[model samples]
Each structure stands twice: as C-alpha cells, then as structure tokens.
Target: MREDTAQEQGLDLEPPVPMEEEKEVMEEMEVEIEDPLPCLSETDTQGIIKGRDLFGYVGIEAVLDQMRRKTMKAGFEFNIMVVGQSGLGKSTLVNTLFKSKVSRKSCTPNYEEKISKTVHLQSVSHIIEEKGVKMKLTVIDTPGFGDQINNENCWEPIVKYVNEQYEKYLKEELNVNRKRRIPDSRVHCCVYFLPATGHWLRPIDVEFMRRLGKIVSIVPVIAKADTLTLEERLEFKQRIRQDLQANGIRVYPQKEYDEDAEDRILNDKIRENIPFAVVGTDKEHQVNGNKVLGRKTKWGIIEVENVAHCEFAHLRDLLIRSHLQDLKDVTHNIHYETYRVKRLNESNANGLALSPLTLENGTLEKSEAESHL
Candidate 1:
C-alpha cells in the first residue's frame, strides 16, 4: 500500500529507527532522578541503628538507672549487729540472711582472720526488690561478746567505739553540703542476738543490753531456736519476761489497748522493749526436734511461722514500715557528717588547722553555731 494510504489506515510504513537515535529520543523524554529525602536524617538513622544494635545494653542501662534512683530514694544504711556468746553461729546466721560470706577465724589474742585482724567486724549488704519496693539490708557480724581470747572486757570498749564512730559519722559525713548537721545517734539501731538454749537472761547479755539501751533502741533476738521444745520455748519466754520485767521491760502479746496503758506499760520496762514472738524452725538443724541445733525457716528465725505466730515479725514490720523513712533521713544526715569530718581530717592531717595555738578557736570551730555564723 502507498505510504499515504498506510498512514490513514493507522499503520507504519517507515523503516525501524536506529538504535542510538531511539536511545537519544528516550533519554530526551525521560524524567531526571534525584535522591529522595529520607524519613530520618543521617544522624537520626545512625542513632536508630545503634539503638537496635545495643538493645540489650540499653535495657541494662535502663535497669541500672532505675536501681540508682531507688538507691538514692532509699538512702538509709542500717547497721545491725548479731551479738551472743561465741560459737553460737552468728556468722552463719548473717551469711544465710544476707547471702554474703562474713566470717572470721582466730589468729591471735583479740585478732580475727578476715580483711583486717583485731576482732574485725564483718558486714554483708544485699538488695531486696519486691513489689517495686527496693530495700537494702546490711548485717554486721560482731564477735560474740565474751570471747575467751579477746579479753572478757573487750565488749565494753567495742560498744563505746561503735557509739563514737556513729557520733563521728553523724557530725561529719551526714551533712557535707547542708547548712546544719544532725546527731549521729538518730541513725544507728542495735540488735542483741541470744542463744536459743542459754540461760534466759545471762548477766553478760543483760549488762550489754543495759548499756546499749542508754544509746539507741535495742531489739533482742533469740537465736538458734529450733533446738528447744515447745514447752522449753514457752518457759524460756516466761523467764525472759520475768528478767526483763525486773529490769523494767514489759512483755505482752500484740494487742489493741488504751494509749495511756500502753505508754505506762512501755515506760515501766527497763529497755521499754517487749519480747518479739518466739520463733523456731527445723531447717537450720540436722537432727529432729530433740537433737537438731535448729534451722533457718522460710520465716526468718526471728519471724517463725507468720506474723500472727511471731512477735519478732511484728517488731520488724514496725521498724521497716513505720520507721524506715525517718531512719533514711537520719542516716543521710549522719553520713553527711561523717564525710564532712573525714574531709576535715584529711585536710588537717599534716598538722595544719584553721587557727593554731588557740584552744578557743578549736572549740568554736567544732561548734555548729560558730561555723554556721
């Protein structure tokens, strides 16, 4: 067909276009391609990739942050000592509770074989996370007061030093940045551990408790109780009641009563402290009820069975639930004072003072009024 007729009929009569000419035509019609803006910038993209790469580390960091915040919020250091006659398993009891090894061995007179000798005090600290509440429990293992080699009179001096250290911490470390300092005694609490089978109120225990009473609130715990029979336990409780009553302590079951009566009752007691409910368990011991020394129960030895069954649980609850916040505040102040004094000592260790050759200046320097003013 003629080219004009082919065109009218909608057909091509022309030869195939050259390859290079077709490519040029296509290129002329093609749209230019430019790089598209990404959803994230280069920096943001890198961050996202890094976050994906370190998901585990990120999670751990988050947990660490939470723990740090909790530590700051619950900034109280409670130093609890377990005291009793030697060989009563004070070290074992503390190690079991705090889940940390705190032990010592005799090396010389008045010396133990831990980090430092000389009846070195051992302590174990652990954190308990429950129901989102984080708590730190520090247990200090003290030498059983009447050590044969440490000298019978070692107990008094140690107690005095502890009190003095507490005072030093309060006046120095507790308030390094604050304008005022709080007393140290407000932060320390004492626990007296007694053997489950020993004489109800040993003279030594009584004397130590009496002295401790003058300084801080003291809690008495009957240790290694699984060794005693139900009847013996009951009798032991009664004897403790009598002895403490003689010393001005009141023993009573947990119950509701008139405020006036409670106050009067507490005031009448020697330490004004009641015996926590008696606790016993069969786990820490190897023998059956008769010969087994006793065992650590699911309920703390101090809180056997349950709160309803043990007075120590009630006492513990009172201290943990009621006094923990106040204790934290007090302990923070004490640590601040301790830190402050330590810094002062370090600064003055070379025999330099703010003023020399004047006792008046020294006295006034230590006083709150003078320093603050």
Candidate 2:
C-alpha cells in the first residue's frame, strides 16, 4: 500500500546496495576527498631544501638581484655621531673617511671660531653618490664635549639627542597615516674619540661611554694615535679595554648580538682589536711613486691608509664597506626597539593620553591613535 501511494505521488524507490559494495563506494569517496598536498602540524619540523633537492629550475636566487636594484634606486641614509674634545681631529677624521667635505670643519672652514663653551650638537648632511648608489650621510659633531675645565655630564646632550630621535620615530609610527618611509635621523654609529694619553680611560671617558654605549653603537678610537709610540698604543688599548670591561660598557658588534657562527667569528676578531688606534689626515703626499693620504712630519709621512702606520683602514672598512648596513640595523632593531618598548610601557602605566599637540602637528590624532601597548 505504501509503495502504491508513493507511486501515485510520483516517488521512485531503488533497491539498497549490499553492505560490502556500499563500504567500497564509501572508501572511494573518502580517497577522492583526501588532499594531495602535504600539511604541517603545529609541532612538525620544517624540512630544509637545498638547491640540489629541487627538481626544476625556480628563479628564487633572482630575489637578491631584485633587492639590489631596489636598494640602488631608493638609496639610504646613515647618520654617524663623533664625540670627543674640540681638538681630537673628529671632523678631520670624518672628512678623511668619506674623502669628501662632509664634516662641519670643511663646510664652515671657520667652525673653530664658533666653538661653543658648552657641549653643542651640530649635524651636517650631504648627498653622496658613487656607482649609481646614493647615500644621505649625516655627520653629528659634538663640539666642546670634554673641553670645559669642569666638564660634568657632558654626555647629557648626546644621550638626550639619541633618545629624542627614537621618540620622534615612535610618534611617526603611532600615527594613523604614517609615512611610507619615515625620515631616519637616529644616530647609527658613534665614533667616540679617546685621547692618546698612553694611559687608562679617564673619569669623563668612562662616564660618557658607559651611558652612551647603552643607547648607541660606540666605536671608541684612539684619537691622534700618531702621537703615541707603538708600545704605548698597545698598552693604552689594553688598558682601555680593561676599563671598558670593568665599567660594564657595551660597544658595537657586541658579542651578545651576533646572529650566527660566521658573525660571531668576524665580530670576535673586531673585539680583540677594539678601540682602534687611528690617525686622520686629509693631505696627500708622494709615497712609493703613488700619491697617498698621509700626515707629513719632519721624520716621515705617516700614510693614513697604510695598515702598518695606523689601523685607519680597518676602521674605514668597518664603518663604510662591511658594517655600515649593520650599524643601521642595530640602531633600528635593538636600540630603537628597546626605547620603543619602554616608552609604550610607560604610556600604558601612566594612562597617558595622546597629546593634542602631536595631533595638531598632524602626526597622530586622538581618534586614530591606537594603543600600541
């Protein structure tokens, strides 16, 4: 009767398949539903693939070429700070490094006449280009840093300046409509000049580097190293290294920051020769039938680029050729990140509102300022 009623309602019923056949059909459907590609679980270790493992050619290596072209077109910025007394040849050394009039002394020519009685921060920037690669190099010169009779807290201005740059960058990052590439003014490397006293670090030197080293990459160098004998230079460098360790000061290419075995090995060599004894000169003289940058004296001309004469070449290579990008990276990643976290934490603790002043300046608005904390 039910089958007759179903037929009257236009319903059709088929015989059920045997259990074994139904099971086989179900298994086939399950096979079709399975994924072809492999998937990783949460705890699965990722396999490393080498070039030899690849079956077909993929243009992955071309990414490096793309990055190189992009970097060449976009250019970059590097801000370096020179800290020392007035007559430490800081400006001269900078000019010699870049082989250009990029220092305050070269720009002003009479910068000595305008030396301030107190520690003053002066920045001079120049757009330098070579081989189609441009760099906006800014040299921050600290005049009268340790010149005063009672030079107390001479590093205050410098420390404040570094933190200020970090703060400026932080504000821009907090803005809703932040720039695609915010202008980088933060000091990347600080070339701290230590006097060639042939003695241990002085109280001022210890204090200044101790504070600044925590905030920036401090590359302490023996200024006017030509004044010291070879023996004196060695002994002085040893003493300074000991002092640095005793005072717990952190300098550039720090061991703790090394990323891998290769970096550690390279930086280990640099650490062994810390506080590079350097002589700076912009004058060129005839040497071995070739003109060379050197300092002329009654005894002989001290070739600046000659490694035997001074460690200036090593310093130049470090600051320019090899570790220039590393300096910028450390400044942005480590130093700036440390400052950013601390500032954000402070804001969270104090419940500080985003300042209207910052909003008025169009950096951050109250409604758009998101709590990074």
Candidate 3:
C-alpha cells in the first residue's frame, strides 16, 4: 500500500535491508555497547603513575643519574658546630669521624695555649673528596664554652654566630644579582657534648640546649663515655632524657618532624636512644689481628666503633650516613626559613628597606649585623 501511494505521488523509495544483514548490524551494536571506549579525563587519573600502567620504557629513572652527575660536579657544603668544654674530646671526635684533622684544634699547633677567656667562635673548613664526590666540611668550634667558673650567657656568642650566618644567606638571597650558588655557612647540626658525670643534665646544659635547639638541630652526646661504667652510662642517659623532657627542650629527630610512617619508626628508635653515650679516640690499637679505633686503658682497650663498648657507631651513622641530607634540609627549610620570615616581618614593621647593609668586603659587618639581632 505504501509503495502504491509513493508511485501515485511520483516518489521513488529504496529497497529494505535483508533480515540477516539487520541481525548482524544489531549484533555489532550490542558488542560496541558491551565494551565501550574509556571516557577518562586528565583530572581523573592525574597522580602517581604505577610501573605497570606505563606502556613501555620511558627512561624517566635516568633523572637520578643526571642529578648525581651534577651534584658530583658541584660539591656541597656542610657546616657543623661542636659545643662543649675544652677537655671533652670535641676535636678528637670530629677528627675521628672524618678520619682527617678537620677541627680547629687539629689545625692549630698550640691550641691549648690559646684558650679564650670567653666563648670564642672559630670555624675551619676543608675540602673532602672520596670516590669521585667532593664535600666542603666546616667544623665550628666554640671554645671557652662552659669552661669558666662564672659561666654567664656563654651561649650568646654562639647564638649570634648562627644568626649571622642566616643574615648573610638572607642578604645574598635578597640581592638582585645573587651568586649562582650562595655559600652556605649556616650551621646544619650542632653537636652538644655533655660531660659523663653519671648525673642529671646540669643547669648550663639545659639552658644552652634550650636556646640553641630552637635555632638549629642539636644532637647531645655523653662526652668521654668510657669514664662511666655500663650501668652508670645507661642510668645517666635516662636521667638526661627525663631532664630534657621536664625542661621542654626539643632535640634532634623531634617527634613532630617525622615525615612518614617509615621515618617515624626509624626515628623513634633513634629517639629512644637519645644522647648517645659515645667515646672518641684518634688512636688505633691491634686487636684480633686487625687495627681498630680505640682507647687503651690498664684493663683492656675500649673500642670506639664497637657498639658493645660505645655508641659512637650509632652517632656516626645518624650524622653522616642516614640523616645527613635531612639535616641540611631542616637547616634550610625549618631553621633558616623561620629566621628569614621573622627578619622580613620585622623589617616590614619598621618600614626599613629590604636591601642588606654591606661593608667594603661585600659582607655585613659583624657589629652592624649583631646590632640588628
């Protein structure tokens, strides 16, 4: 009937599709409907691409090698400040750690003759190279610290020095034409030595650490641990830890700074063993057909690296191997950032210009810088 109507109207119509062809088209449509193409947007799958998600080799891991090469070419700087009295083996420990005479006392022939009446800051820097890598190691020594009978405000000099370094770096950063690599004299870590008296933390110790801990990373250790018995050492460490808590002093590997679960676990172990009871010696003695770094007493030799004898190994691992980079990062990001923000805010409030004052040597004069502080 439709065909007859179309013929009467002078309209031409095409023939209908066969039943089998129609069925095949329907099957194809069903197949497409069952397995549609993905409709993912960039925002949906934007993060954390897994290895299996990659189609083929992309060579993205080569960035590590590139970074290593650059770092090797441009050596980094690490400045460590050692705070203790003269007879605490601070110089000996530093030399023992690096296997080189990098301390101020080591460099000076008559160091004992030149003891300062007040706290004096001296820094000695040396370029250390090993296995195609170079590092500029600077050891800051605080002489006459805690050495005087009337020890009043001995930490003031140390505090001033730390701020001076921060000021220097901040000045360079604020400069319009800054150096490509601003020399980092900022103290990364301050190793505070406590005498192994087998007693609680003294007032001076608590006060010094309390002030310095806020500005830099402080790692307290029992200097000359061999003087105490094993039980005495453990008890002394416990007492010191309790004192640190009661006094509200924050030491390194602080709980709040843990970055992740893994870091927390590792640092928790270190925290439990805080204020490592360490013995330092530059002399080596023959034991078991091999030479070992140790101090010889009348009874036997006390091995410095042996865990059973002393915790120097743990201290070394923490400072050099495990948390070295973290120390640097904390110095720059946490300590220095805090100082920078405070200084900038003060300048803003005072309506002072951001431009740094400079002396003839293109550096801030010590007196002028400390005046601001």
Candidate 4:
C-alpha cells in the first residue's frame, strides 16, 4: 500500500527506532515498582525479628546498682500524717514509729519532748539515715482535730493540707524545666487514730475517714488498745470494718489496687487485720527482769512492741516495713494520679489547658490554674 494510504488505514510505513534509542526509551520510562520488604536475619520464639541476642552479660543489670547509688545520694522523702483527737497517744505513737526504725548500735536515747497541740496544721521533718541511705521523714500532726464542741467540717483543714502538698508537687511537675527530683512533700500515709471504743465506729470516725479516704492513704488504728480486752477488740474491729465497707471508705491496700497475685495475697492478710489495735508508750517498764517498751499498769505490764499484747507491732510493720514504699507508690500512682487527671480535666473544662498548648515565644498566659498549681 502507498505510505499515505497506509497512514489512513492504520498501517506503519516508518522504520523502527535503533536498539540504542529503544534502550534509552526503556530506561527513561517512569515505571513505579512496589518496594520489597527488608530481609530478616532470625526469628524469635514469638516469630519476631528483633536483633540477635549477644552471648555473655553486657552489665545492663548494673543499672540497678547505679539507681541505688543515685537514689542513695539523692535521698528520698516520706511524709506521714497522724489524724485523730487529742489524748489518743498520737504523739507517743509517732515517736515509737520513728524510734524503732533507727539503728540501736550507734543510736542515742530518744529524749522525751512534749508535742504541743496546735490549733492549726503543723508539719515536722527529720532526716533519718541508716547504712548510707537517707530519708526525709515529715510528720504532720493536727492538735485541734475534733477538739471543738461542734466539730463540723473538721476535716477541711486536713484535706486542705493534703491537697496543698499534691498541688505543690503538681506545680513542680508542670514547670517548663522541672527538677530532676521534685520535692515529694505529698503525704504518703495518714495514720488515723481511732479511740478504743468497744462499740462500732462513731459518727465522727465515719465522717472523717469517708472524706479523707478519696484523697490519701488512710491506715486506721485503734489507739489505747491496751484498754480493750482481746474479745472486745476483735468485735470492735469487725464492726469498724463493716462500717468502712458500708460507707464505701477506702483504706490502704485496697482490693482494687492489687498489682499482682503476690500483692493480692499479702494485702488480703492486711485487709483481714484492718484497723490494727495499737498501743504506744515512750516509757519503758521492767518486765521479766528486762527493760522493754511497755506501759506500767497496776495489773500487769502491757508491752507496746509485743504482738501478743497489742497490734502495735503489726501497725508498725505495715507502715515502716513492708508497705512503706508501697504506700508512697499508691499515693503517687493511684491517689495523686486520680487527682492529676481530674485537675487536668478541670483545667481543660475551664479553658485553662489550651489545645496545642497555646504558647507564645514559649510563655504561658496567666490563669487561675497557675496560682492554684
């Protein structure tokens, strides 16, 4: 066919391109190819390709020692609050709690100093050190708690004090450049001193614990337990536990907070022995020809540290021994975390927490939260 007729009839009369031109055209073609996956060296037991495990130790376990040394140098904070009415041996118990923890090998006698009643809040701190480990122990005591005839809202001051400490910690946390270790003045535990009433929990006791249980860890104790007989004490404890459960009061080692099976088992034992009947005494009496910490009674000597005589040892063990650090953890992780979430939510609700952090030149605008925090 003629070239003109071939073009109209869809027939090619032109010669093909050269091999070099064809190769150039093929190379110039912008074809998108799907990317192949990376190669896997080995699979773990779970079929995951993480890196190969090295033989021998890398001394990563030394981080624990490093943390220990760092913490030993930095020290730590333990804040406790003792809440109850006067004449419950709150002062004596506080002394006993601290004194028993000290090393007797090089320790001097603990001088008896009267803890005067304050109409308001009072916090006392002492740096306790043992075996190169230092702890800043602060004890908060209220003198006029339930001292008024019409003790209405007596928990206001105590609640205010606890929240204030949390606020201080939160403020430090919210700072643009916070310290490596913020001073933790937050109350780790509140030892609620309940009078040795042979009967059930009183209205004052119920009210106080009901309000305070939400914000802090409360470890209720039966003060002057030496007065109650063993049977009476057991009955009273059962009643108090019932009242606590009925009122929805949360105490230390609460069931919902069991981290694991071991924790649950241990805390279950403590829960069974809740509201430990405790007796405190600074004076020592001669018992069995040996000087021991006990109250000199006309009938016989009531040993303060003796588990048979009272639950003071149990209370002490729970507070200063096994559950001490756990108390602080619960305060920080659970109670303080709850407060923090609510406060953050409130700040957002109040338009204080801005989206994208509403910053200008890395400066925050003044708000009510700034002052409160």
| lDDT winner | 3
Model 1: how far residue 43 lies from native, Å: 68
With a 3 Å backbone cut-off (N, CA, C), the pairs that clash in candidate 3 are none
In the order shown, what is each candidate's alpha-carbon RMSD?
Answer: 18.7, 7.2, 6.0, 8.8
Model 1 CA deviation exceeding 4 Å by range: 1-74, 95-119, 149-151, 173-187, 248-273, 277-312, 315-373
Angstrom error at residue 213, model 2: 1.0
In model 2, where is the ten-residue run with the lowest total lDDT? 364-373
Instruction: For residues 249-296, write the lDDT of model 1, one tens digit per residue.
Output: 422221222137754464344233355433433244433353322345
Best by TM-score: 3
Clashes of 4: 0
* Winner by TM-score between candidate 3 and candidate 1: 3
Alpha-carbon lDDT, every model: 0.51, 0.86, 0.88, 0.79
Clashes of each: 25, 0, 0, 0
- How many clashing pairs in candidate 3? 0
Candidate 3 lDDT over residue span 13-130, tens digit each = 9889999999999988874343233445555664456667777989999999999999999989999999998789999999989988888878987756456799889899999999
Candidate 4 residue-wise lDDT, 165-271, digit = tens: 77777777888888987989999999999998788888888988888898899999999998889999999999999999999999987999888999999999999
Report residue 356 deviation for candidate 1 (angstroms). 13
lDDT of 2 by residue, 134-175 (tens): 899999998878888998767777777787788788878888
**Candidate 2 has what TM-score?**
0.85
